[model samples]
Target: MMIIKMDDNQKLGENDHRRLGQELDLFVFSDLVGAGLPLFTPRGTVLRDELLRFSEELQAKYGYQKVFIPHITKDELYKRSGHWDKFGEELFLVKSQETKDQMVLKPMNCPHHIQIYASKPRSYRELPIRYMESTVQYRDEKKGELAGLVRVRAISIDDAHVFCTLDQIEQEFTTIMNMIKEMYRVFDMKFRARLSFRDDSDAYIGDAADWEAAQRTIEEVTKKLDLHYDIAEGDAAFYGPKIDIMVTDSLGREWQCATEQLDFVMPKRFGLAYVDSDGSEKTPVMIHKALLGSFERFLSVYLEHTEGRFPLWLAPEQVRIIALKDDANILKMAKDVVKKAKEMGLRAELDDDNETVAKKILAADQMRV
Candidate 1:
C-alpha cells in the first residue's frame, strides 16, 4: 500500500486513505496512457458490475429494448443530427485507413438511436419505443481539464432514447422524470431539477410553433409531478428544451446526473416518421433521457461525494474473509467461505497469508471495501 502525507500538521483521525485510491488500489490514471482515462483495477471492476446490474433491473422494469451500436460512426451521421456542427469541438474524429471517409467516436448515443428508430416504418400503435444501451463513448477533452474518472477521454453513459408521438410526449416524459427521481432515491441522493430551454433568436432547427409546444409540455409535466426546478435559458439543445437533475453530494457539491430532453429536430433531420391513427405520416417527437449522465463523471462525482466510502451494496468488496492465522486449516476454511460467498452472489475476498489480520482489515477498511 502507498501512503502519502496529506498535511504537515497533525495526523490524528484523518482519512489517510482519502489518498486511499492509491493506497487501497481501486483505480489508476497513468501519464503514459493519457489523462482522464482510468484503468479500473480488479476491485473497481467488481463495483462497476454492480452498477450494471442496477441499470439492467431498471431497463427490464421500464420495457426498454436493449441495442448496441458501433463505436465509430460515419461523419455524415452526426452532421445530419447537428451534433457534428455544434459539438464537433468535443468529438473525436478519425479518417478511415482504407477509405477517404471520416468517422467519429460518438460522444453521445442519440444519433445512433435515431438510426434505429428510422430503421423501421412504424404506426401510431408503436408511438413510444424506449431503447437503452450501456456502452463506451469517446470525447476529446483538453488534457489540463481531465481529472480521474470525473473528466475523462472515454465514458460509459447510461443512455436511453424514447421515441413517441406529439400527444404521448408529455406522458412519456413524466414517466422518465419519475424514474430519474426513483433512481436518485436508490442512491439516497438529494437532487434539484433544471429546466433548460432555448433562446428565441437561436438558429436552431424545427419550427417556432413546435418549440413552444414542446416547452409548454415540459412545463406541464414538471407541474404535474410537483417537481421544483430552476430554468436555465440557452441551456437547451439545438433541437429542444430539457429537464436536468442535479444531485448534491456529501461535500455539498452538485452534479448533473439525469436529463430529459425533447427533440423535434433530429427526427426531421433523419427523416424519422410514423403513421398516425388517421394514416397520415408525421414526424415523431424524440425524448432523450439519461438516468446516469455518464459513468466516468458519475464515478468521479460519487467518489468525492461519498469520499470513497461506497454503500455496502455498491462496495467492491462487500465482505472480506480473512484468516486469523496462516495455518493450513485456516487457509482451507477461508477458501470455503470465499466460495460460499461467491455462490451467494456476494462480492467477497479472502486474504490469507503472512500478513497480520489487523493489517488486512485495515487495508479493506481503507478501500471502503
Candidate 2:
C-alpha cells in the first residue's frame, strides 16, 4: 500500500532480469539440470557471497550467533512445526532405501533451529538466544509457475530466530527493525511496513488470545519505532502475525524482501522453555526473521533496479586494469595495479587480452566491470 518514486530511466526492453542475467552471464538454467534450478556462475556467486557477507556482518553487530543445519530432515520435524499440514503439498518427499524412514528436503529451517534450542535446558540468564544462518531450503514448485530467479525450487534465505521472554519482545523486534533499515538504506531501496495479521481464518494455528497478544505487541513496536505501516489482514503467517517489509524497486514495483514475525505458537509446540526467577518453566516467544528473504529474488529485483550497474563495493569486478599496449612494461604495470588492488581486498582483474584497446574497453563496459 506504500508508494514511492524510483529511477524509471530503463527502457521497457532493458529491465528484464532474465535477459540481463544472460547478457551479464550471472546465472543459467539447463534442461538436464531440470527447471526452477539456477546455477550461479563464478560472477553470480560473487554477488551472492557479497550480499550474504553484508547480512552476516549486520547481524553479528547485534549479537546474533551463526548456526548451521542440514538441508534434509525427517518429515516428522515439519509435522511437529505445523508446516507439514500447511505446506505438505509443496514438500519434496524422499524415500530412504536403507530404512523405513520418511525423509524430506527441508522446506524451512525453524524446526531444525528449534531442535538446537531444545538440546539443552535454558535459564532466564540465557534468554533472547539469537541464531542466524544463510542457507538453502527446497520446495516442490509447479513447473508452470516457475520463472527466472523470482520463483525457484531452491531458495536461499538469510534466516534467523530469536527466543526471548515476553518482556524482551519489544526490544528484540526494535533491534531487528534497525538492522533491516540499515540494510535497505545501504542498498538504496525505499521500503514501508505491513502489519500482517490473521483474519477470521481457520488456517492459522495458536489460540485466539495468543494471536491477539502477538499482534498487539507488533503494533506497539511498530508505533514505537515510528514506522509507516498499514494493517494487512489475512496476510499473516499460519502460526503468527508478522511485520513484512515491502521494498520499492527502481521500476516503482514493490517486493516483499524482509520480515520479522512474532510467534507464540512454535515455541510452545516445540516445548521450548526457560527457568524464570520464580523457579517456574515459561514458554519463550519465538521471532522468525529474514533480512533478505530470498537471495535469488532480491538479486532479481536488484539487477533490474540498478540495471546491473552495482555499487563499487558490491561490483564483482571492482577494478579492471586494461593493458592499452602489448609492451611488456604496460602489461607489467597493469598486472601490478591489479595485484595492489587485490592486496587491498578488492575484486580486481587485469585484462591483458590480445585485442584492440577500444574492443577491450567495450567488453569491460558490457560486463559492467
Candidate 3:
C-alpha cells in the first residue's frame, strides 16, 4: 500500500527483466508447469547457485549453521504457529489417501525451524542459535496478482532465524543488519530502513504489551546502529515488528529485498523455551530475517538494475572465446583460452560454431556474455 516515485527518465521496455530473460535464455515458462512457476535453464541455475553460495559464505562467517526442512507440513503445525489463521486462504491444502493427516505446502519456514530449536533442551550457553536456509516456499498466489519473477507462487528465500534471549536481541540484530548492508553494497545498491510497526487493529497477534516491547527493541537497535528510517504503521507482520530494508535500484525504484523482524509472539505460541542461568525455563525470542527476500524477486530487480550486465563474479559465462575464422589454428587457440580460463576456476566457454565472427559477437553481446 506504500508508494514511491519511480524514475521516468529510463525506458524499461528494453531492460525489462522478462524481455531480457527471454533474450538471454535464462529461464522459461511452460504452460504445463502451471502459472507463477518458473523453470530455470542451465545458465539461470548457475546464476542462482552462485548467489546462494555467496549468501552461504556470509552466513558461515557469522556462525550460522545450515539447516533443511520439508516442503510440506501437517496443517496442525501452521495452526499452532498462527500462520493457519493469518494466511489460511493463501495455503495450498493437500490430502493423502493413506492417512488422516491434513497437509499443506509450507508457505514459511519459521515454524519448522522452531521445531528444530525445540528438539532438545537448551542451556543459556547456546542462547544465540542461528539457522539459515535457502529454499523454495509455495504460496497459492492469486492468478491475477502473478507477474514474471517478482510475484510468483514458487518463491526462493534466503531465510534465517535466531533464537536468542531478550538481552541478546540487540547484538543479534546488529549482526543481521551488517550482513544485509554488505550484500547490497556488493550489488552496488543503496538502501534505507523502514520501521514497520503494527497499528491499533485486531489483525495483529500477541498482546499490546508484547507488541510494544518488540517494537521498542527494534527501534532501539535501529537507533543504536544509526540507521536512517521512517516508521510505517500497520506495516508490521502479524506477529512482530520489522526493520525492512528498502533498496533503491538504478532505475530509482525502491524494492523491499531484506527484512529483520523481532518476534516475541511465535516463540510463546509454540512454547519454545531454554533454561536460563537461574535454572528456570524462559521463552526465547525469535528473529526472522531474509537477506534476499526472494531469489526470483531479487533477480528481477537486479537484472533490471544492471540491465543484465552482471558482474564477472556472478555472470554465468565469465569468458567467451571466439574464433575469428574457420581456420583450425584459430579454433585451437580459442579452445586453449577457454580451457585455461576454466582451469583458473572461471566459467568460460568457446564459441567455435561455424558462424560469422560478427554474428557470434552479436550473439554474445545480446546474452551479456
Q: Superposing every Cα of model 2 onto the true structure, what RMSD results? A: 4.5
State the lDDT of candidate 3 residue by residue for 200-281, as single tens digits: 9889989899899888888989999888999999999999999999999998999999999999999999889999999999
lDDT for residue 251 in candidate 1, whole number 0-100:
68
lDDT (tens digit, per residue) of candidate 2 on 1-369:
222322253233556888788889999998899999999999999999999999999999999999999998888899999999999999999988888799999999999999999999999999889999999999999998987899999999999999999999999999999999999999999999999999997989999999999999999999999999999999999999999999999989999999999999999899999999999999999999999999999999999999899999899889889899899998898899999999999999999999998999999999998
Model 3 steric clash pairs: none
Tell me the tens digit of each residue's lDDT in model 1 across 221-240: 89888988888888888889
lDDT of 3: 0.92
Superposition-based RMSD of candidate 1 using all C-alpha atoms, in angstroms: 3.4
What does the lDDT come to for candidate 2? 0.93
Comparison by lDDT, 2 against 3, better one: 2
lDDT agreement with native, every candidate: 0.82, 0.93, 0.92
Give TM per candidate.
0.92, 0.95, 0.95
Query: Which consecutive 10 residues in model 3 have the weakest lDDT in total?
Result: 1-10
- Once superposed on the true structure, which residue ranges of model 1 sit more than 4 Å away at CA? 1-20, 200-203
lDDT of 3 at 339: 89
Backbone clashes, candidate 2: 0
